[model samples]
Target chain A: MRLSEEQYELIEAYLNNELSAADRTSFENELQADSELMAEVTLQRDLRLGFRAIGISQALDKARAQYNANRRVEAVPADPSSKPMPVTRPLSTWQYWAAAASVVVVLGVGYFVFQQTTEQPTDLAYNETFVPVDELTKEFPRGLAPNTRQQFLDILKEYEAGNYSTAIDQLKTLPADRQTVHYRNFFLGLSYLANKQPTEAIPLLQKALATPSVALRQKAEWFLALAYVKNGQKEKALPTLKRISADKAHPFNLLAQRVLQKIN
Target chain B: MAIRPLPTFLSDQELYDALKRRDDRAYQYLYAESFPSFRHWMLTHNGSEMDAEDAFQKGMLSFLLNVETGKYQFQASTQVTTVLFEYCKRVWLTELKSARVRTKAAMPDSVDSMDTGNVVEDLERLEVVNTVQKSLSQLKDECRKLIEWFYIEELSLREIAERLGMKETSVKSKRYDCAEKLKGFYAQNAKKMGL
Candidate 1:
């Protein structure tokens, strides 16, 4: 009772609501007549749910990481001297000399390693850090007019399909009203970056960081830092990257740290 | 170091909508905002911090699954945080009941009044998710990516074709093949898990 390709496609279309009214009615009638078909539909639905759960589970992991990081930051003593100090005998002179010697050895090794390694290209760092946004996961902000929403969705389709040049063109033509400016800027910046025009991406991404949505702002910050690196403005990227890397609760903290290591 | 502020929702409905949309900020906000009080509650209820964390993860997963699958609906009377806390509390209670740790503390009368829906059934459903996840992992790299992009990412055939540098027709055929492979794996895993 294995389904053929057409049957599979029809079932998928039915589930996705992509079938026409007549087709849907016919499919429903067929499903009612066939128990196996109904079971297949149920299985497909469950499988889709499972896939979605995986995505949700990943999001939960991110949330957990952020919570733990915040807790760690909160756990740090605000004033080091406020806590009772452990009573210990003073370090012997030989113990002090040994500690000093260890520091000198470590410094020597670090200096030698620094001298031997050439600075890696920013392209390497950019490539390592820059993951394009999954356009499908994003929803258009509320308050968009129907026509404007359709236009934006079409642009996202292009972007998702890797038609970045077309997406860029479509994005530019969208009206940058207060309601739509942030959405337009973010996607356009992403499009330009994906299309290898990081110079054009920088300003748009910078504007996108002004988005009222915390999630969108976090995304913009990460991409803007990458845009700086890709545009050979490493010095400009430093402050943002350093801020992100130092903040354990930031979603992109580890990635920012890796980028810093590669570039520096 | 200044901690980053959690995202604020205008209302419980807004938070619920954000959760349904799988917004990362909402998840983080929920976790951060709910945890301190939940941890304190756990500590006072004969549970350790580790127990609290485990219950929180399992409870959050179940609550979120219910939210996404329309098993739970938003009610203006009940705040999202309250619902989340109840779910975690039920998870802890279920664990305590199973481990015979309930005798250590006198159970509060309020615990029996809370309508935390069947935690055991919710966990059973999660096992199905685990089976699907394991089956997905067993797929070959190409098939796995194709299945993920198509199903999870919801990318279209044409979009996937472009990314893979294949013709749309070929991509369609490949998708069918990959999906069949996934079904085979899923069936085996489901049987193994007695689902």
Candidate 2:
């Protein structure tokens, strides 16, 4: 049965439990009398449930991947230290002096080892935390022509494929306006960052912060901070990092806090 | 040794809001805060790391979907992590219970009396969704994208029209047509799969 727009909305409201008690009772009565209406409701409910299930499944996969990536970063050291934790032992007079000399040499190596471990966390945080945005997973921006939409998708596909240079060239072909402006700036900035052109990434990310979508703004702000860090502008990154750290709800909150601790 | 920082928010509501928006930071923060303890519980309960991981993911997806759909009403007294652990625990328990039933093994004493009806039903629904999702892949690229944008992403007709450079009226009709095509494909696939 082909339902009219109003009928579809009414059925959706009923199925979603948004209907008033009186309306719900009336709808139940209608359902009892009309087999076609009952069938249509069932179809609508199943379709919705199906979409929701699939959406959550995709999200779960992404979350699992993110969790695994984070776990891998913290689990093992790239460079193992030569000396394990020190243990105390009683020593003879001659052995004491010999041990003292060895201690000095050990201290020298200790400092180098300390430097290696300390340096790793910051770089590791950047590398492990930055999962390249999947373009197909992202909702395409509204209002492009069919060709433009295809073009945007092509650029996104290239970006996902690590062809940042080609993606950047194609991104530049897309016109910017109120609707397309944020997306162009954001994706272009991401492409630049992935291409190791953080200097070029900064301005676009800053512009992307002006987007109406809070999610897009949050993404832009995050990459903007990372861009500053990448460009060796740690001082500029500080404010954004602090802001993210302060906002407990931000997706980057914990990571921002970690990065801030390392650099500080 | 560097200590991992905890998420900044003090309340579950704030964290839930971030998750609903699909914020990666929130996802990561929740992973750090909740997964370890849940994994530990799983290990003690005769579950392996892989089992824990799978349960955690499924539980998280279920919880988030409920939150998104307004099926989960927040309780001021319940910590978000605590609730999440319960969800993960239930998923594992349900799996264990079914495994025992299938193998004719003794039921473990650790199995609680909590209901597994919703979790089982949701899993079954997920199977149907998976089947239909594969069917969606068989659709022409334009029709698939159109239906996905409108239904799955819930984009407004105006926004969709803007994206495709079509008039709102045309986009509205296109949405209907695309939905019908998707339903046709889904019905055929569902019958084939006996779903």
Candidate 3:
């Protein structure tokens, strides 16, 4: 049986130990009488255990990285001789040139290694290319119930104000009728991207690409490509970005070309 | 992100408490401190550096899971490092026995005497964890994030509301919806995995 919202909240409160002693005692008495409620509680408890396990695993991964990085730092050998060597004799001109060339080569190699290790061009490109679409509600979808339409308009205010997490939460609550589906998906996808969740953004943006409006489809395709890049799926992004770059009339043509150069 | 220095605990109890709390710094400190000796033990036990690292990670994960779940309780007599080392050693020994490497070298009597818990049961528990992880990944973005933020990150409803720009009441309702969706995914996954 589908639990009412109140029932769901009650279960959560019990699971979280947020209920009072008297209330918990009464709830336990209710569970004793209801096998279904007992089973529901067990399932909720298991789900929470699973969630906590996932959190521990993620924390362990971070710790592992930190431990490894610290080891690498410690493993680097300290130079034993800090004092400059006294010149025993004047160096020959060829020897001086050879020493100068060696210094130049060493500096060049160090700089190359540093650049290779530290530079992330695709990340730079994504940061540069992904400006959030302004005024998301400008073409507010028609035929939404007045209340629903008003709710969406309010959500757009959060979106525009850079409160993407809030926008995403409210967006998920909106009723996605046939007319509003694509619009909701597009804005939801945009909010996900703005919140640095490219993995979440990618699928929704792909769905948004099927929107009937050519202009919205173009925007969706552009954002989809950017999401792919941000998500480390550059290969998936290439075809769409190439298509955009090939069409000078496409609004994102210049931006796509620039991103392609950086990623490549 | 900047790497913070590993935190120090004044006593084994403090370290155990931190581990039970799932403190990231405690995990890091334990990992860094224990690995060198564990690596040495592994090298002497017919294992390579990679094998040592693998065994240690698996062991650490299993042991910490037990601690968080209250299967392993703190004891004043047992140093945290000693217990951690023992766990890693047991992991390597289990791997060796499974691979039949014990035939190549005499099994250490010391290790054989220790109470090494059931390896098969440990693996089964880890499998459940894997199933949960897979189910979580399959959830839609909104539901996954909401669940993670609420349950994993332990964010309060009011804190999540502030971040989402919603009222606390709305956030609470949304969390319930997301949680229900997660339960749906988990049930399907559990069935598929025969859990």
User: Which sequence of candidate numbers ranks them by lDDT, best first?
Assistant: 1, 3, 2
Stretch of 10 with least lDDT, candidate 1 chain A: A106-115
Higher-scoring candidate on TM-score, 2 or 3: 3
Candidate 3 segments exceeding 4 Å error = A77-264, B1-6, B46-50, B95-122
CA error at residue A192 for candidate 3, angstroms: 14
Give one digit per residue, the lDDT tens place, for model 2 in B111-186: 7465889887755665565555655655665776676677666788899999899999998777777766766777
- Candidate 2 whole-model C-alpha lDDT, 0 to 1: 0.63
True contacts kept of each: 0.34, 0.20, 0.36
DockQ score for model 1: 0.14
Candidate 1 structure quality by residue, lDDT tens digits, A1-264: 577999989988998899999999999999999999998898777677788776776566446544433433344535444422111111111110000000101000000000111232111101111122332235357777889877877776565444555788788777799888887898888776654456677899999989998777877887787777755578998899899889997756755675675456
What number of clashing residue pairs does each candidate have, in the order they appear? 0, 8, 1
TM-score of chain A of each: 0.49, 0.50, 0.50
- Reference-based TM-score of each model: 0.55, 0.54, 0.55
Candidate 2 is scored at a TM of: 0.54
Error of 3 at A158 (Å): 26
Task: Tell me the TM-score of chain B in each candidate.
Answer: 0.85, 0.81, 0.81
